[model samples]
Target: MSAKSTVDAKIAQGKRTVVFSKSYCPYCRRAKQLLKDANEDFDVYELDEFDEGADWQNALAEKTGQRTVPSIWIGGQFIGGCSDLEAHQRSGKLKQLLA
Candidate 1:
Protein backbone atom coordinates (compact mmCIF):
# COMPACT_ATOMS: atom_id res chain seq x y z
CA MET A 1 0.00 0.00 0.00
CA SER A 2 1.02 3.56 -0.54
CA ALA A 3 2.32 5.62 2.36
CA LYS A 4 -0.73 7.86 2.18
CA SER A 5 -2.97 4.84 2.36
CA THR A 6 -1.06 3.47 5.31
CA VAL A 7 -1.40 6.79 7.12
CA ASP A 8 -5.11 6.87 6.47
CA ALA A 9 -5.61 3.33 7.65
CA LYS A 10 -3.67 3.92 10.83
CA ILE A 11 -5.65 7.00 11.69
CA ALA A 12 -8.95 5.31 10.95
CA GLN A 13 -8.08 2.53 13.33
CA GLY A 14 -9.53 4.80 16.07
CA LYS A 15 -9.18 4.71 19.84
CA ARG A 16 -5.45 4.50 19.34
CA THR A 17 -2.86 7.26 19.25
CA VAL A 18 -0.31 7.45 16.45
CA VAL A 19 2.84 9.52 16.30
CA PHE A 20 5.06 9.94 13.26
CA SER A 21 8.40 10.78 14.80
CA LYS A 22 12.15 10.84 14.29
CA SER A 23 14.37 9.03 16.72
CA TYR A 24 16.68 11.97 17.27
CA CYS A 25 14.11 14.68 17.63
CA PRO A 26 13.83 16.05 21.15
CA TYR A 27 10.29 17.23 20.41
CA CYS A 28 9.35 13.72 19.44
CA ARG A 29 10.80 12.37 22.66
CA ARG A 30 8.96 14.99 24.71
CA ALA A 31 5.66 14.20 23.05
CA LYS A 32 6.15 10.49 23.52
CA GLN A 33 7.18 10.95 27.12
CA LEU A 34 4.01 12.87 27.87
CA LEU A 35 1.93 10.05 26.46
CA LYS A 36 3.91 7.48 28.36
CA ASP A 37 3.53 9.42 31.58
CA ALA A 38 -0.18 9.44 31.02
CA ASN A 39 -0.13 5.68 30.64
CA GLU A 40 -1.30 6.00 27.07
CA ASP A 41 -0.60 3.19 24.64
CA PHE A 42 0.46 4.56 21.28
CA ASP A 43 2.17 3.60 18.06
CA VAL A 44 5.32 5.37 16.99
CA TYR A 45 6.71 5.46 13.49
CA GLU A 46 10.22 6.77 13.69
CA LEU A 47 10.51 8.29 10.25
CA ASP A 48 14.27 8.58 10.25
CA GLU A 49 14.63 4.85 10.79
CA PHE A 50 12.64 3.51 7.86
CA ASP A 51 13.24 3.38 4.12
CA GLU A 52 9.78 4.74 3.41
CA GLY A 53 10.25 7.36 6.08
CA ALA A 54 10.29 10.30 3.72
CA ASP A 55 7.29 9.03 1.87
CA TRP A 56 5.40 8.63 5.10
CA GLN A 57 6.38 12.12 6.19
CA ASN A 58 5.32 13.51 2.83
CA ALA A 59 2.00 11.73 3.16
CA LEU A 60 1.55 13.08 6.67
CA ALA A 61 2.37 16.60 5.49
CA GLU A 62 -0.21 16.34 2.76
CA LYS A 63 -2.79 15.00 5.16
CA THR A 64 -2.20 17.32 8.10
CA GLY A 65 -0.50 20.34 6.54
CA GLN A 66 2.17 20.07 9.18
CA ARG A 67 5.68 18.98 8.19
CA THR A 68 7.17 18.58 11.64
CA VAL A 69 8.05 15.38 13.45
CA PRO A 70 5.99 14.07 16.36
CA SER A 71 2.99 14.54 14.14
CA ILE A 72 0.32 13.06 16.31
CA TRP A 73 -3.22 11.82 15.94
CA ILE A 74 -5.64 10.53 18.50
CA GLY A 75 -8.82 8.67 17.72
CA GLY A 76 -8.35 9.59 14.08
CA GLN A 77 -8.16 13.32 14.73
CA PHE A 78 -5.06 15.33 14.10
CA ILE A 79 -3.35 16.58 17.21
CA GLY A 80 -0.56 19.08 16.73
CA GLY A 81 3.05 18.65 17.82
CA CYS A 82 4.71 18.70 21.24
CA SER A 83 3.62 22.16 22.35
CA ASP A 84 0.07 21.45 21.33
CA LEU A 85 0.12 18.23 23.24
CA GLU A 86 1.40 20.10 26.27
CA ALA A 87 -1.41 22.61 25.95
CA HIS A 88 -3.95 19.83 25.74
CA GLN A 89 -2.54 18.18 28.82
CA ARG A 90 -2.57 21.44 30.73
CA SER A 91 -6.19 22.03 29.83
CA GLY A 92 -7.12 18.43 30.63
CA LYS A 93 -8.23 17.96 27.04
CA LEU A 94 -5.67 15.30 26.45
CA LYS A 95 -7.21 13.11 29.07
CA GLN A 96 -10.64 13.71 27.62
CA LEU A 97 -9.45 12.86 24.16
CA LEU A 98 -7.76 9.71 25.36
CA ALA A 99 -10.90 8.71 27.20
Candidate 2:
Protein backbone atom coordinates (compact mmCIF):
# COMPACT_ATOMS: atom_id res chain seq x y z
CA MET A 1 0.00 0.00 0.00
CA SER A 2 2.58 2.51 -1.11
CA ALA A 3 -0.01 4.45 -2.98
CA LYS A 4 -0.82 8.01 -2.03
CA SER A 5 -4.46 7.03 -1.79
CA THR A 6 -3.72 4.73 1.13
CA VAL A 7 -2.13 7.54 3.08
CA ASP A 8 -4.91 9.89 2.10
CA ALA A 9 -7.52 7.42 3.30
CA LYS A 10 -5.79 7.02 6.64
CA ILE A 11 -5.63 10.76 7.12
CA ALA A 12 -9.20 11.26 5.97
CA GLN A 13 -10.78 8.79 8.40
CA GLY A 14 -11.57 11.85 10.59
CA LYS A 15 -9.71 10.62 13.61
CA ARG A 16 -9.66 13.98 15.51
CA THR A 17 -6.02 13.49 16.34
CA VAL A 18 -3.28 11.36 14.79
CA VAL A 19 0.43 10.92 15.06
CA PHE A 20 2.54 9.45 12.30
CA SER A 21 5.59 8.30 14.16
CA LYS A 22 8.31 5.71 14.68
CA SER A 23 8.75 3.77 17.92
CA TYR A 24 12.50 4.28 18.12
CA CYS A 25 12.57 8.02 17.55
CA PRO A 26 13.15 10.09 20.69
CA TYR A 27 11.26 13.01 19.18
CA CYS A 28 8.35 10.78 18.39
CA ARG A 29 8.44 9.46 21.94
CA ARG A 30 8.45 13.00 23.29
CA ALA A 31 5.55 14.01 21.11
CA LYS A 32 3.47 11.06 22.27
CA GLN A 33 4.46 11.69 25.85
CA LEU A 34 3.40 15.29 25.65
CA LEU A 35 0.04 14.36 24.25
CA LYS A 36 -0.36 11.67 26.88
CA ASP A 37 0.57 14.04 29.66
CA ALA A 38 -2.03 16.45 28.41
CA ASN A 39 -4.57 13.65 28.31
CA GLU A 40 -5.20 14.34 24.67
CA ASP A 41 -7.08 11.68 22.72
CA PHE A 42 -5.02 10.54 19.77
CA ASP A 43 -3.97 7.50 17.77
CA VAL A 44 -0.40 6.75 16.89
CA TYR A 45 0.65 4.78 13.85
CA GLU A 46 4.09 3.36 14.42
CA LEU A 47 5.52 3.57 10.96
CA ASP A 48 8.37 1.24 11.85
CA GLU A 49 5.90 -1.61 12.15
CA PHE A 50 4.95 -1.36 8.50
CA ASP A 51 7.14 -3.19 5.98
CA GLU A 52 7.06 -0.19 3.66
CA GLY A 53 7.25 2.38 6.42
CA ALA A 54 10.11 4.21 4.77
CA ASP A 55 8.24 4.47 1.53
CA TRP A 56 5.16 5.59 3.37
CA GLN A 57 7.21 8.28 5.04
CA ASN A 58 8.41 9.36 1.63
CA ALA A 59 4.87 9.59 0.41
CA LEU A 60 4.00 11.57 3.53
CA ALA A 61 6.90 13.88 2.85
CA GLU A 62 5.47 14.57 -0.56
CA LYS A 63 2.06 15.12 0.95
CA THR A 64 2.88 17.26 3.98
CA GLY A 65 6.40 18.37 3.12
CA GLN A 66 7.64 16.94 6.38
CA ARG A 67 10.12 14.08 6.17
CA THR A 68 10.39 13.68 9.93
CA VAL A 69 8.89 11.52 12.60
CA PRO A 70 6.09 12.67 14.90
CA SER A 71 4.08 14.13 12.07
CA ILE A 72 1.02 15.28 13.94
CA TRP A 73 -2.48 16.18 12.93
CA ILE A 74 -5.18 17.72 15.07
CA GLY A 75 -8.67 18.33 13.80
CA GLY A 76 -7.31 17.26 10.41
CA GLN A 77 -4.65 19.97 10.30
CA PHE A 78 -0.99 19.11 9.96
CA ILE A 79 0.69 20.55 13.06
CA GLY A 80 4.18 19.40 12.17
CA GLY A 81 6.82 17.34 14.03
CA CYS A 82 7.99 16.95 17.65
CA SER A 83 9.58 20.34 18.13
CA ASP A 84 6.60 22.10 16.68
CA LEU A 85 4.29 20.09 18.91
CA GLU A 86 6.43 20.96 21.91
CA ALA A 87 6.28 24.62 21.02
CA HIS A 88 2.55 24.41 20.86
CA GLN A 89 2.55 22.55 24.17
CA ARG A 90 4.55 25.30 25.78
CA SER A 91 2.40 27.99 24.27
CA GLY A 92 -0.71 26.25 25.66
CA LYS A 93 -2.12 26.15 22.14
CA LEU A 94 -1.95 22.38 22.24
CA LYS A 95 -4.68 22.26 24.83
CA GLN A 96 -6.78 24.57 22.75
CA LEU A 97 -6.26 22.43 19.70
CA LEU A 98 -7.29 19.33 21.60
CA ALA A 99 -10.42 21.04 22.77
Models 1 onward score TM values of 0.95, 0.91
lDDT of each: 0.93, 0.86
- Which pairs in model 1 have colliding backbones? none
lDDT of 2 by residue, 3-85 (tens): 57776767778478888899999999999999899987787888999887787788889989888888898887899999999
Which candidate number has the best lDDT? Answer: 1
Q: In candidate 1, which residue ranges exceed 4 Å CA deviation?
A: none
Candidate 1 per-residue C-alpha lDDT over 9-97 given as tens digits, one digit per residue, 9 for 90 to 100: 87787449999899999999999999999999998889999899999999999988999989999988899999999999999999999
- Candidate 1 weakest ten by summed lDDT: 6-15
Q: How big is the positional error of residue 98 in model 1, measured in Å on the Cα after superposition?
A: 0.8
